[model samples]
Structures are given as C-alpha cells and as structure tokens.
Target chain A: MATELPSNIKSSDVLTDQTSSKWLPPGLALQKVDERIMTLNVGPQHPGSGHMRLIVQIDGDYIVACDPDPGYVHRGEEKMAEYRNYITNIPHLERPVIHDSCNVLYPYVLGVEELLGIEVPERAKYVRVIASELNRCIYIMYWLAIYGIFLGHSTMFMWPAGDRELLIDLMEKMTGARVTHAHFVPGGVRNDLPPNFEEVCLRQVAYFEKRIKEYAAVFYDNPILIARTQDTGVLSRQDAIRLGTTGSVLRASGVDYDLRQKEPYDVYEELDIHSNVMKEGDSYARSKIPWLDMMESCNIIRQALQKMPKSGSVRVKLKPNPKGKGLNTVYKRVESGRGSLGCYIVSDGKPEPYRVKLSVPSFRNLIALPYLLKGEKLGNMPSVYWSLNYWPVEADR
Target chain B: MIGTATGIIRALNSGIKHLAIKRFTLRYPEEKLKFVGDGYQFDPSTGVGIAGLKGRHLLFHDHCTGCQLCSIACEGVAEAIAMVKVPEEHKQNKKAIMPQIDYGKCVFCGLCVDACPFYALYMTNDYELSSFSKEGLIYTPAQLQVKPYVAQDSEIIITSRGATHG
Candidate 1:
C-alpha cells in the first residue's frame, strides 16, 4: 500500500509561526501569544523516551501537537553494508535488532542466497524457522518486560526477564552468545543444532509457555494497567491501514496482516502460524497483541521442531568470496520482532554489494506516534508510546 | 468494583506465590555458568560450524600454515585478527606468522574460525577477558596457544517451584 504524509502536517517547519523569536523552537511559537501552548521535549535522554526525542506541544495537560525526533542512534548501517561482502555483512547488519538478530538477518540471508544462486537444504530451512520463532518470543518477552516497567509494574519486569532466560539458554546452546548471535548466514545458518537440542528446547519452551500464561494474572489482567492503557491513544483500523503500519500495531487495529501468514518466507508455509488480531486499536490492544504473538510463536516453534529432518547438512559449501551472478537487484522481507524487516540489495556481479537498504519496521511504525499522541493527555504518553513496540536503535539504523 | 478488586487481588496473589521460588540470579566468579562444549568449532570439510559458546580465540601453532585467510576474513568484519610474525619455527608454518587477535575489537562472531581451513583457530568458553590495560586484551599467537582453565558447573535447572541456576 502506498502511503504519504498528510500535506498539512508534512514538516515541523509548517507548524512554526512567522512572529516567533529566533531563539524559540519550531513548535513553540503561535499566532496568539495568550494561547498558553507549551512545548515539552520528552527526550533523547528522558526515562520514558528511549534514545530518541519527542517534541510535544501541550495546553493545560492536553497535547496539541507531537513530533518524534529519531536518528540519535543511526550508525549508517546501509552505507557500511556496501563496504563489506555478503558474508561479513552478517555480524554488522544484525546489530540493529540484537535481541532478534536471527529474524533481522533472515531477509538479508534469503536475499543473498537468491543473488549468489545457492540452494538451502530442507533441514536448514526448518532450523531457520525454529530459530526465527524462538528469537521472536525472546524479543516479545523483552518488549513485554519493558512495557511492564514503563507502566510502573516492577513484578512484570522481573518475571519476563527471568522467564526469557530459558529461551536465551536455548539460543546460546544453538547459536552461541546471548543477544547478538550472528548465527544466520547466506547459504544457511552458521552451524547446526547442538547435541540433544530438540529435547531441551521442547522442555524449556513448554515451561516458558506456562510461565508466560502466569503473566495474565499479574501484568495483563491487572486493573491498574488496564485503566492506564485502555481507550488511550486509540488508532482506528482505517488509520492503521492509511498509515501503513506493520506487525503487531497493524494487527491491533483489526488488520489481519502478518508477513509470516501472508508472505510465508522460508519454511513458514509448512508450519501452522496463527495471526492474532484485536479490534480495539487502543494501547491495551497493541500491548496485548505481542503476548498473543508470543503464544503463537511457541506453537510455531513446536511444529517446526517436529517437522525438521533428523539428519542432514544445515549449511551449503560456498566458494570463497562468492560473488553475485550479475547486475541484479533483490528485495526480501520477513516478519521480525518489531515488524516486517526488509533488506534490498543491488549487486553488480561483485563480492561487495553496490547498495544495501534495510526498510526497518520501527521507522515505519514511528509515523503513527504523532497521530496517536495528538489530542491525548500528557500523562498517558509513556503507555501509548511504549505500546507501539518501537525499538529506537532499529528505527535509527 | 468487584472486578477491579479481584484483579488487584489476583496480581497480588501472583506476586506472593513467587516468593517461595528459588532465586534465578547466578553469583558470578564464585559460580560460573557451564557451557555445553569446549567452544565453537568449524569443520572445513563439511562447511559447517559446531554450535558452542563464542568466546575467546584459541590458536594451534602446529596447524597454522600462515596463509592469512583468517586475518583477511576478519578485515571486513572487525579487523580483530592480525597476522603477526612469531619467532617460533614450525615445519607447517613457513613464515612463522599466526592470527594475533585483539579481543578489544573482536565481536566474537567466529568468522575467523570459519575461515581457518587448517583448523588453527577456534573459540573457547573463556569469556572472562577483562583486563586493566589495553595491551592485555590482545592475545598473541603464543598466548592463544595456552588453553585457559574454566571452572564452571552451574546450569539452569527448571523445577516445579520455579527455574533457577543450580
């Protein structure tokens, strides 16, 4: 779907008045001096804001206008990708979403494999699917943990953080390293499953599922959290579609669109993936969608584990410094923890790509922030903002 | 009012029930978490790496051919592995050079290990690479040859009460 910014609110420059003093910020000045509109910067350093600034203009606790200032953590990831070959780009590209590195690297690996003309084995495909689902759960847990602390729920923070260790332990045994597991490669994964990994994964995942179900009592069903987030920052189904929101945010608004269900990259078609949707479009719905997705992820992982081939090669033997076939462009996207993470590569028959572009979901979902925040009370900002499942580092990258 | 009260009570009950559960935190130094294997190793013949903890780099002087493939691989990624000329004379190693890794820059992605066709390099489960000085962080080929002793036994034991590092 093609989406464009409403011309009325194209830029912060349009919001400024000619009568404003040079020293004042863009959104501060108004035509009428007595309007009592005050501008508040949530932060590049504020507790609620994560590495990005929000320029919020408010009047008597009601927000008049909001602007999200991202790019504090931008490291020119795309530009750096052009310098490195396809294989070396694995470690660097996965940095944006360290928590879901496998999912982030999934599209890049898929795209590279297409360009280099390498066939991934059936076992590798199954392993990739399992790893991806596991990573999705890990990411959603982290997000849920943060969503808890953001809503002044301490127990919510501790439980998910602790419960997440089960999967992280599994990931370490599978890929190595806790957060930035550069496990996914072009031809296939960097390695195969460890000895006796299936039994351990199944045992831990079953336990992990039970643990998360307990969260309903403590975090999700809590009256205080429900009161704070429900009916606050409601995004309509039409608005969600118009804004081109992806992942949980889109699903929260009654759009039954998930890249896994719709696109079915890799072995997703073989596995039974349930795309959860909520009709309500509030902060509560947005927050609840990821938890539901985590449940679905657990199911997907179980099915993938069952379907995987017992014994086969997980990686293809590629020629050293493998170059692209010819001057060609390939775009591949997969449903990541945040949203649909797309990788676009332009290769000119070189080991190093001519261009690499990552269409990150965080950046796309960010467009809804100003739309959702406007006309809402200032106090509900953290709940609404954090509920979007926006990761600042990925957006900035 | 009843719904709200029940919700609050339910949350409180969940919190109280967790008090009996064993502590999840592991006391580091005193108690180190054990890894599954020695380290991450790659088989050049199979073109696949064995899954293990990616920690510090280990060097085998006997296996190193001084081909500089590992160094060349690391150049695009981290430039952590440097081919340094060593004084030791070996029959296989003509130039007496091996990968001297600066752990400070190493992301521990294990690409260099993957690049080593002769199996000269592999990652070990010795991640405690903290040093006071910057010079100490760089492991020479000789320093990498000595395998560090790891005393780790703790594993995550999930029980009915709750999971804990035991």
Candidate 2:
C-alpha cells in the first residue's frame, strides 16, 4: 500500500522538503511525513525476490512491517488439469517446479494409481525412490545456489550449480529429460532404467557426496555467514507448527516430522531415512537442514539400488485414456523440494478430471515470511527470506 | 577478527582450488554429450517406451497409417503435432496425411512417440533445433523424415582431484 501525498505544493517548498519527500507525479503535491518510516518496494523484477514482491516499511534500517506479495507467476495449473486426461497431465503438472519434477508428479501418480486400482511393480517402487531422491538433491542444490547468490556468496552459487549437474546427468540417463522429466505416470514410471545404470549412478553420486561436503568449509561453517544469520529471524518450535510451516523450516524449529519418514511412500519404508532436525529455529538452521537431508537422500539412493530387483518390469500396462471407476475424489501428498505437496483430484467417471487442487508447500511456507521479516534488519532480509526456501513459481501455481 | 579472516581465507582457498579443477561446462556447438541409445522407441508387446532424451521426432512414412493417435495425445499437453496433407501417397496412409510438428510449441515430452503403436514415431537426440523464424521451426513431414547428424562424444570423467566433462 502506497501513502498519499498532498494535492498542491509550491516549487520552493518542494525543493526545501525534497530531503524527506520522495518524487511524486507531476500534478500531486508532497505531504509532510508524520513518522520517519520509509516504504521500499522490493519489486518482482529483483533477483532476490523471485517473481514476488515484498512491500517493506523500514525505520532506520530496521524493518517495521513486511508484506509478501505472491502470485506473479500463477498459471492456474489446477484448472488446466481438469481438462486433460490422467496420462497427459504429467508434463504440464510438473512445469511449476521443473527441477523437482519427480516429487511434484509423485502425488499425482499416487492419486491416479489409487483411482485406477492398479498395483505398481516392486522394481518400479525402488526406481521411483531413486528418481525421487535424485530430484530432491537437484532441487535443493538449485535452491542453495539461489540462496548463495542472494547472500552475495558467488563461490557458493558456482559450486552448487556445478555439482547439481552430476545429479541432473544421472536423472537424464534414467528419465530422458534433464529437469522436466515427465517420467512418473499413473500406475508406474514411463520406462525402466537404462542398461549399466547402477555403476554410473553409484560412482557419480559418491563423487557428488564428496563435492557437497566441501561446501561446509566455505559456506555453512564460515564465521561471517554464521554471525550474519545465526540468531536472526528466530522462529520458535510452537510458532512454526501454529503457522503450519513444513519441510526444512519446520525441521529447523525442532520438529522431526519428515513425510518420507512419518508416512513412507513407495519404497521409502524399505529404505532407512534419518530425519535431520535443529533446535536453533534460525536462518542458519534452516539453511543447514537441506544439506543434511541431501546427505540422507544419497544414502537412501544407495540402499534402494542394493534392494531393487535386478530383473523385472517397471511399469504396469494401462488402457489408453484411463478413467476412474466411480465419481470420487482422492487426495495424495508427497514430500517435495520445499515441503509437503498435496494433489486433490475429483474424478467424475470420465477421462478428464472434474476438479484438481494442488496444495503447494511454497504457498504454505510463505505464511512465515511476514512473521519472520518484521523487526529484522534490512541486510538480513535476503538471508532470512531465501533460507525459508520459497520458490515463487511453485507458490503461484 | 581472526575468525572472520580464517573464514575469508577458507572461502578463497576453496575458490582457488576449484580454479585448478577442470571446468564441468560442455562447450556447446563444438561438443555435445553422447546419449545411450539411438532414440526413444516403443514396442507394441510392451506397454512402456524405452528411455532416451525426448528431442526431435522421427517419422516413418511407411508405418504411419494416418490414425492421428500422436496428434490426439499432443492435444492436451502441447498441440505441436498437426496432421497435414503430404504430396507423396502411401498405401498405408490412404488419407495422404502426415503429422508436421511445430518445435516452438513442443515441450519434448515424448508422449506422442508412446501413442504410436505401429513403431512409426520415435525421438532422436537432435536437441539443437534453434531457428531464426517461426516458419523455420515448423518441421514438415519430409523434413522430419531426414535423420539429424549429431557429433557428440563428450562424457563426464571423475578423478580423485575432481570431475570434468571431457
């Protein structure tokens, strides 16, 4: 919200009051400021804002009020899903968060499979687990890269960007696409893993784990970064749950609830997953949790590879234009890059869905932005805001 | 002050170490990463299509029966494939129609290839399909028939020091 200035003013008065007043339209006159609070529009075009605006009012470098403005990149993905068939919606549904396509499509596939009443093969479950883990790391690395850039750490940005390619390369061999792999479909995945995939996957993922460990020395353990973000924008454990925060943000606040661990999906129950939690409830804790999760994902991938069936079908054959049995609604959720991503589909016994609703984690985590941003310093904005792992595109979708 | 200095030095040291490491970037146009298979193919016996990068479409004029399954599949996702009247007539294609794909609108999802049961359509690793004009992007049936020649030999080589694309 913009403040209204006076309607009329003299040129001499305007020059005298120029220090306190901002430039207005030619016809509008300057108004006398009652309080010294200045409003700053961190617009959508800014790199740090990520297609969302933050209306912040500052009083001497301290943020007095912060209002997050999302929905700049909304494409109405839910409405579009109603027109498309179950099989065709994969490519478009994964577009909101392309790097984490597997996780985004995970819930949709699960819901569709339930509606169809078909069981996924044992091999398919392990393959799905591997893909989901790889996608999780890919999404985290991209988020970390952006977080690094926002904090003015250029080396942090480059390292994650470079290291992300290893996972991306692995994903490409499995799913055919680099980022937007519409591999996960109803009943099962699109195809089986490529020949000689296990060796390549194991080797690359091992190297990637070693590469990620190098980041702690230069980034997470860096004293300057620690001092800047350690105690700033502290979110208490109760506040996090009351505000309905999920994923890393919630974990940082000492809640050890991971969807993969709590409500195990696919082959996640078979594999051992350690939930990383921190009690600090600060930006540093939020930033560190994802790295720990990435390490856990690496272990899960190795375990899945070992337990996966050597020779079996990865997909269950479904009839062309598959439809639900009855007029019913099904809701399925999976742990995505940001947090819990839920997909609710209302089927009316037709090829097309009657209604589709996506409960995205980005939008859910955005509730904590204004709460955390208020009374914080201006310089801490980027570190605190990005540490929440808010992807505006996913939120807006 | 000492802690800050050590942090800065560690960051600088990490950066300098990476400078000695080989670049992971693949110099495009001159080098391309080689794919595993020829293209993404579907078998009628099997429900799933083989895994490969969904790049450019390869159409077989003989096997295509002008059934319009690929066009139907692309309708909801990306309406990039449209059936057009071809000059050459085939016995299988009685309508003398073939699918012409608009690369500009195509998401390269490979659903179209899976929709074709006759093994008439597949995707090749010809991702370098940049065009200057809109008209140039719409590949005709005849154009789609021509197999692209790609010289890709690069692969990721990981050593004790670091990984490099070579």
Interface RMSD of 1: 0.8
Residues A1-397 of candidate 2: C-alpha lDDT, one tens digit per residue: 2335454545555443445456454324444554689988988765543488888889999998888888788898988998899989989999889888999999989998998898999999999999999999999999899889988988888889999999999998888888899999887888889999999999999999999999988999898789999999999999999999999999999999999989988888888889999999999999999999999999999999999999888888889899898898999999987889999988999999898888999888889998998899999999999999888888888
Candidate 2 local lDDT, B1-166, one digit each (tens): 8988988899778777877787688897788897878767777578877877778999999999999999999999999999999989899999999999999999989899888988999999889898999999999999999888877798889997789888
Give each prediction's root-mean-square deviation over alpha carbons. 4.7, 5.1
What TM-score does candidate 2 get on C-alpha atoms? 0.93
TM-score of each model, paired residue for residue: 0.94, 0.93
**Candidate 1's TM-score on the B chain:** 0.97
lDDT of 1 by residue, A1-397 (tens): 1122345545555544445434465444333433488878888774432488989989999999899988888889999999999889989999988889999999999999999989999999999998898999999999888888888888888888888989999999999888899998888888999999999999999989999998999988999989999999999999999998989999999999999989998888988888999999999999999999898999998998999999999999998898998899999999998789999999999899999999999888989999999899999998899889898989888
Per-prediction interface RMSD in Å: 0.8, 1.2
Q: Which has the greatest lDDT?
A: 1
Candidate 1 lDDT by residue in tens digits, B3-109: 99999999999889989987679888899987888889999999999989999988888999999999999999899888899998999988888889999999999
